[model samples]
Target: MSKSKQELLGYQSHLIQDNLTYFKPTRTSTTVTFAEEIRSSLQEPKKSISPKFFYDENGSKLFDEICTLPEYYPYNSETEILQSIEKKLLPYLSNEFHLVELGSGSSVKTRLLIDVLFKSQKHLQYFPIDISEILDQSAKSLCMDYENLKVTGVVDTYEKGLDFIEHYDDKPNLITFLGSSFGNLDHNEGMKFLQRINTLMKSDDLFLIGLDLKKDHEVLHNAYNDSQKTTAKFNLNVLKRINEELGADFNLENFEHHAVYDEQKGRIEMYLRSLSEQSITIPKSDLSITLSKDELIHTENSHKFSISQIESYLKESNFEKLEMWFDSRKYFALVLGKKI
Candidate 1:
């Protein structure tokens, strides 16, 4: 583990039986300023920004809405598979393992696994890690619901959170990275992340990951470019975020959301395409850039995987495949494995 800009801010929730502690970040040398990241990204010839920035308050709300859209299948499909197979997963779980989740947004789907873990144990220790303050509310709710469960919520990036926890306790961990968040990383990045997790785990520690599977190009396209244009709004909000936070002059209407499934690449590419030739400036970043008509600023990529591809990823990362649960349509997968 390496040093990060993250520091632990520990506090007991008074409303509960002192069962919840939340860790908030404080400044450190490793912190990267948003302005600097935006400037560098804009200077790239590809003109792309990391999708993680799509989570400004408004963007997060919009994304929550997107999950409910009829055209969006990943959330629903994954939920279906989890509900169907959660009990079946119980036999594979260790008797006394720390329950941890990475990027644990709202912990909506995680409740299934958490509920299952409760079946065998009277008291449990759970950790939910995410960068959002939403974890605060989620932690409180879960604490109230599970009186005997102790929750340690970490508000930090996945890497820093893992670093903190790797040193905190020695209990074998059943860590999960759900909601297909891993798809945001390309193959190399995904492998590297998994390797880091492998380093954190001891033998027989468990991992559960959600992945969207390869499917028809049209289905993928519709999912990201819904008729209601919710995904469009979600995609364009990043530029709006830049304008508000980085002091950028970006006319929201001057760009349009564009998402298309690249069947050859087995991914959905999202972009904000310039509607016309325009110049933009960000005062804080000291940046000015010009875009030609239809010029794209790459935003996100949702990579869909095949079983073989996922198997190779796990095996290469030193994970022994345990089981993979899928929906009837096979549109999504929940792969469970053990660190070797």
Candidate 2:
């Protein structure tokens, strides 16, 4: 894997273990069957898939590629914003704080924040939770070089609850859910998620969230569609996953990837459109689904936000926005909120 600028800093030292236990997901055939059933049902009329399923080991890697594509503005825009504001953001962080990150994907962009924090604080503990085991291992190994950093990696989704973190001794924690991963949820669901985090925090704890700003439709569309075709492959990989896990017959070549910004919904919709009428069977679920020509199966949504809207959401979720930072173009934002 390619190391970002912050990753180089994390590797300069040696691995430090905080004696944190590794959490792994219990893989069962039922899980695969459930996924197939959900996919089949979503195709009937209104189509959708839980964006959570898009981060299997291969999906994680594909997404990393999508970030680097020239057409993908979200990754670069957010990275630029973080790198530019990290210096200022450090002053708001305390020296004794433990950094907990939600949906800590490969923890690539997070290295930018962690590196800056380690530089100023000297000795800070870290916890990164994600559902992808591959990403968890990748992040853990990368952080190994930071001798003073102790990592507690959890392989679970944020929606599943944070019971995994209960064993740890309580302290002033700085929790972050960066990369606008929260955008995967609808407005109501997103607020509920924030409320859940508010329950997890003490009065003095901090929450830093990254959000992609609303921008030109063309720019947003290109970010998801990508001229390099990486995003397309990433979108279609779901079917490949189905074939491998559930004994589904899905010809990857039979479908084309489509992503478009839905202005009314303020979200990017990803779908796999069938080039021709096709029938797919999932042996594990003992289910069959038929697709008409040009039919689409929705895959994911990336919702953009405005600063005012986010602040309102924070208030509703029992959090108060403390500070916010943005890039020169104002393409992205990193907002820090305190539990109220």
Tens-place lDDT per residue, model 2, 39-151, is: 56655676556666677778888988887788877677778877887667777777777777887744667677778788668877677776655535655565576677666
lDDT of 1 by residue, 23-109 (tens): 765545365688999999998989998898998889988999999999999999988987888578878766687788897564578
Q: TM-scores for all candidates?
A: 0.92, 0.87
lDDT of every predicted structure (CA atoms):
0.83, 0.74
RMSD of each: 3.3, 6.9
Best-fitting candidate, scored by TM-score: 1
112: Cα error in model 2, Å: 1.6
> Candidate 1: minimum summed lDDT over ten consecutive residues — where?
5-14
Global lDDT of model 2:
0.74
